[model samples]
Target: MEFNEIIERIVKSTNLSAEVLNSKINDKIAELDNLVSKEGAAHIIANELGVNLIDSDASQDFVNIKNLVGGLRNVIVLGKVTDTFPVTTFEKDGKKKQVGSLSLNDGTGFARVVFWDDSINIFKNIKENDIIKVINAYVKENKFGKLELHVSYRTKVRVNPDDIDPKSINATDKQSKAEFVDIVEIKPDSFVKCFGAIVQVYKKNIFFNVCPQCGKSIKSDEGLSMCSEHGKVSPSRKMFVTFVLDDGTGTIRCTSFGRDAEVIMGMPTIEAIKLADSHEDSTFPVDSIKSKILGKEVFIYGRTSLNTFTNSIEIITSRIVENIDYNVELKRIAEEVEFGDKN
Candidate 1:
């Protein structure tokens, strides 16, 4: 957290003027023989008044930003506020829903946090470089293939505390061991990191109906398209792509949805849907998807699940990176499997 955030927090929490707090902070620094910075001095004064700085429990399993992946919940992250964007509003269910996004960096890497509805107000006055702590956050991947933290109903926002040392939070040793596992070792509903060749691309119902409101696929009941929660709705077409991944040990189908599907298609899903609709063959982009994605070794990070229709377990990849360096991947595989002497 920066000194500005401390000062702002102090003023907001105590109804004190910035000028008065600045003067007292300077005085405390002088009294302490210039031993502490302005922020440190302000913290001392706040402590003397029996006030808390940032409300974070030190016991939290706060990891570096780069370690964040999807399927994580109740995450506690401690990072400096690096960037903040303007709040934007969009209509949802006839009411304006406001959202805001900001970047938090812990020197290891930066992760974005999106504040929804009421959470946006917490960072409305936040400034760049303000040290921040997010409590009970959730992780999800955005459209652009980046993992992000989201402020939820249980989320709490805290500012800088005196106990934290920025130097101690350096990124030198915090890189993730989060690469893909071998294809044969995948388990149900677990996010697996693995790289394998796209041996085949499955051709089935690659497109489906989706409810606009909740964004889940709408089920067809007779002639009526319906959502389980929001019934009798107009539906939109969505992409549901599946492909085979081979890691020598075994092959498993990898599924991707929506934004990830769009990425694989190299075009917006809606555009693909339109092309499919216009074409008499109804197999639009099949050749293109096969040409680009198949016969390639791609890195995948996604959850594994059993496809009910096929009764076979498959990986649902959230993100895929193509044309990985073979030497580095082999090293990671060796470390994970202890493949050398096996002593």
Candidate 2:
């Protein structure tokens, strides 16, 4: 789990305000002297969350916040709900599934608790600054190589009895965190990261006429055109390019338009359309545009959607990074985590 994941999980699980919680966490960390102490102390707002560490005489094991690691199963922990991320819904096998998580902290350290599917409802009721105990939760690393808890149907989430009402923490800090994700995991999420190589480019209908006002495909009436949705209108040319991206495991057909398509074509949409229109009767500059992208590498920050007509996933490219080495970027991230080390 990343720091934002930790911060988000806490903000959502308790009634505490995110703005206040962020401020309090940052202020606590700023007071610490060294990296290790700063990291550990940053988690537990002792008076704010009212969490305590306990041990039983039995042989059963319980992990601490700072000791959390990836790939741990049947793990249990007791912590205060610190913060939470916004709830997100995604489709899996044609059915919708919801996911949410909360940041949990004992005095020793901090961790993220993720809720999935039906389990997400329980976490939904949990508010910030609530004292909660989770049993039978599992741990895993996210795209950024940090530990987070993944709770399942078998996991137990409960609110501990307390006499006092929950209070909001000072969540005023605005530290930012971002990470790149695999292309396979791309879906209708935020501006997520994806990298792949262009396997093929489909150039037919790369540029076409659309209604200037509403952007719907137009019906040609000699010089003037008619839009089915908007009636009569002037026509404007737009780029709509389709291509294939291969990421070793699979291939996905990607469709991009306007500015993103122009990035691959190396020219403006109007210019390409004019060059094609110069021909006797050309729909688009098929051969010229295709020549620009076949077999090239690309990194796209785009939006993914499931096409109901095809019932398959497709991408709408927003930003493109042509032929950049991703391995080098990952190495740089690792170096920053190990040395500078601010969570």
lDDT of 1 by residue, 221-309 (tens): 99999999999999977887877888898999878887767655556776777777777444666655678767776666777788789
Cα lDDT tens digits for candidate 2, 3-50: 565566566657777677777777777755434342354356533575
Which candidate number maximizes lDDT?
Answer: 1
What TM-score does each of the candidates earn? 0.45, 0.38
Question: In model 2, where do residues sit more than 4 Å from their true spots?
Answer: 1-179, 187-191, 213-224, 227-231, 281-284, 324-343
Clash count, predicted structure 2: 32
List the RMSD of every prediction in angstroms. Answer: 18.6, 17.7
lDDT (C-alpha) at residue 110 in model 2 = 63
